[model samples]
Target: MQRNTLGNTGLEVGPLCIGTSTLAGFTETYGYDVDDERAVETVLAVFDSEVNYLDTGNNYGKDGLAERRVGEAIRRRGGLPEGFVLQTKVDADPVTGDYSGARVRRSLEESLERLGVDHLPVLALHDPEFMSADQDGFGPGGALEALVAIRDEGIADHLAVASGSVEVTQRYLDTGAFDVVLNHNRFTLLNREAQDLFEGARDKGLGVLNAAPYGGGMLVKGPAQQPKYCYGERDEAFAASALAMAEACEAAGVPLAAAALQFSTRSPLVDSTVVGISRPERIRETLALLAVEIPPALWVELESLRPDARI
Candidate 1:
């Protein structure tokens, strides 16, 4: 439960952050389901723990239902404790697919309404690949422009970019517009493509939130239980490689989940590691995984098993 300063933002967060994507019910994006009562319980459990950071998004579920659930959890608690940080994303328009500055403003307004908060400590532009990479999103009157306005207005303390593509992520980071950069399903025990981007972000003095340390649940569930890497079904080669890593963890007396979580948090490139959860038990399990120790020899064995793509 120790905290780390998120680069130049001066925002302190735990090494482990609880992500709320699963708080929304079944969704095609994440392919998971959790009822309302359970989702609330899970979020409350994280709040009650030593963890102080919560990550969510506007498009986490159909029509941003996940944000509402998170809001409900806060309302149930009467109010969030002092120093607690809530982070969320302003997603691309569901219908128009626009990420213009105006769209960014509208998205934030909706998010604030749903979450029952006037402002956010962190607000990121989620999935920029969905828009025009050059002009529409990053140019004049672009999404970044709107984000900076929000920060200056005291509506959002920090602005960041979270993307599934390392190239897209690095481009935003290099602009020097965002305070933090969040890249997921990469920089894990199985993938290192984000390594270069992480280094670049650090050099620019930007914070790094390495998400999906479990490789979209594959590292935790193992290839046998979850055959997919990232969001797609794994190919035969990746399947074999993942299975081999699982076997290595088994033989070394280390849980693959523990190895993945530790591998992400231990890196100098990562300021915080984000893990998603659906139920209260999963929070406890993630905490246990974070506490479990991994041997140095096991890391050497893992270096030879890294996945190729950052996604």
Candidate 2:
């Protein structure tokens, strides 16, 4: 994998980044539990791999367990790789749902302690669009304001906006406080809702991260097996489109996972594609998927088979 400059952060990152949401054991979301040993081993695998970027969140588990597992791996290795980039997002208090400036600061501090790091390369205000105006984030004494202060304090190298809503993300980018933008499940094979958001971020010299190329599992697991897009039950038509795409890939002698992954990796708008891994084998599988020889005709057919409406 070739390394590329991540916007103006002066950091070099590969086209793939390891996401730790599932590694934290979100059984309800992924329908599986990742034991502590398994999660730590997975991070160790990533450290030995070619990819140098990692993404985690403050509330990825019951108590930021994902970051703790990552920190454990780092401890065994003595430290982070020489040029590794570790990014984590801030979340509202799980108990009180407070996203105030003070809460943002506390969330980051907790993340640092969990990851066993004093500073971060990038820190994102995660999922702020879910809150209303003048509260949680983007208002007076909100999380967004604290993010800027944190960056200014040299606690974090750069700031990022990682949200699902395209319009909400564009609004954050417009503030010009963010150096990177990350959107998941909205730019995958079955969805193009983030197209304009990516375009705008690219034009502004901000890093673009396209996460969840698998549409939360359907594209790779096969519609018959997964039957969901982004872990949410979609309309029958959406499931039908996924089924057709899986069949198309089969006819073309390609793995549906490869097409789904490369759909984000091969795009010009994306600097990195975030993939979740809970097991050690996934490290090698993801790399193999990246190397698969996808025929050009398969891309054409997949594009044509895109849902008439975005999921």
Candidate 3:
């Protein structure tokens, strides 16, 4: 329920942002169900809970259906909160794996029409690796140019890049264009790359939004249930580490989800963490977890269980 400023953009976001990727079936790209109604309900509940930040993307569905659904939900609710912040990603080409300047412009225009918003609170480049691989295709002359133009024209309030790698984040930081960065699974018990990112973001005055705080459900469900879109496979050592952390949480009377959400926020560099909610009950569960603080001794134990190296 705490709020933090998003870098220098003058935007205050909740500690837990609502992630809409699952709502659009991105999780199902491997094997998950598409729950449009439940997704809308979740968003509504998030707003009701005073969590005003929503993160989505244009390529979430066949033709920006996810953005449309979010837009409709806000409209049906009469409108979003007075100072609510809506953030969405731009993918160059949904059908083909192509990212270019022209595609970026087209995507933003279409997203605006679908969302029924004149300007986006925050716009992020979907994937860091893809953008780095084709810098020209996504660089200033390309998508970045379009994004800056939009900001200048008052079509977007700020620009951001959502990535999964430290290297990719550093590249964007070097450009000095992004106002914030969205990172995934970097600061988890299994990885500590976030430490470096935190330092970098602080030095550059960029706000950090930590995604996949639960390691894409692995931390919540445990290793017995493998994550659908995980970057690596689960092994015995990884399973052991996860179990140790889970047991520590149990012993300390703290839910793993609570630890996950609070861990990132404890870092001064991290502004917020995004948690996906499929059901209203899930929101209550997460909120309850958020209310409990992880003890210092418990944090030390949790850190001891971290993997020595990345997978």
Best by lDDT: 2
Q: Write the per-residue lDDT of candidate 3 for residues 285-310, one digit (tens) a residue.
A: 87777789778999888888886742
Between candidates 1 and 3, the TM-score winner: 1
How many steric clashes between backbone atoms does each model show?
Answer: 1, 0, 0
Worst-scoring 10-residue span by lDDT in model 2 = 130-139
* Model 3 CA deviation exceeding 4 Å by range: 27-31, 131-135, 138-140, 227-232, 309-311
Which residue pairs collide in model 1, if any? 190-307
Stretches off by above 4 angstroms in model 2 are 132-136, 309-311
Worst 10 residues of 1 by lDDT: 302-311
TM-scores of the models, in the given order? 0.95, 0.96, 0.91
lDDT tens readout by residue for model 2, 1-311: 79978887778899999999978878777778989999999999999989899999998998999989999999998999989999999998899888889999999999999889999999998888876464846677877889998999999999999989888888888998999999999998888999999998889888999988887777777777767787787547667888888888889888999999999999999999999889888989999999999999988888877887434
Model 1 ranges with Cα > 4 A deviation: 26-31, 132-135, 307-311
Clashes counted in candidate 1 amount to: 1
The better-scoring model by TM-score among 1 and 2 is 2
What ranking of all candidate models by TM-score puts the best one first?
Answer: 2, 1, 3
List, residue by residue over 55-169, the lDDT tens digit for candidate 1. 9999888788889999889999887867898999998788877778998999999898888889888899999877865447766898888888899999999888988899888
In candidate 1, residue 20 scores what lDDT?
Answer: 81
lDDT of 3 at 104: 80
The model with the greater TM-score, 2 or 3, is 2
True lDDT of residue 176, candidate 2: 88
| Among all candidates shown, the one with the greatest TM-score | 2
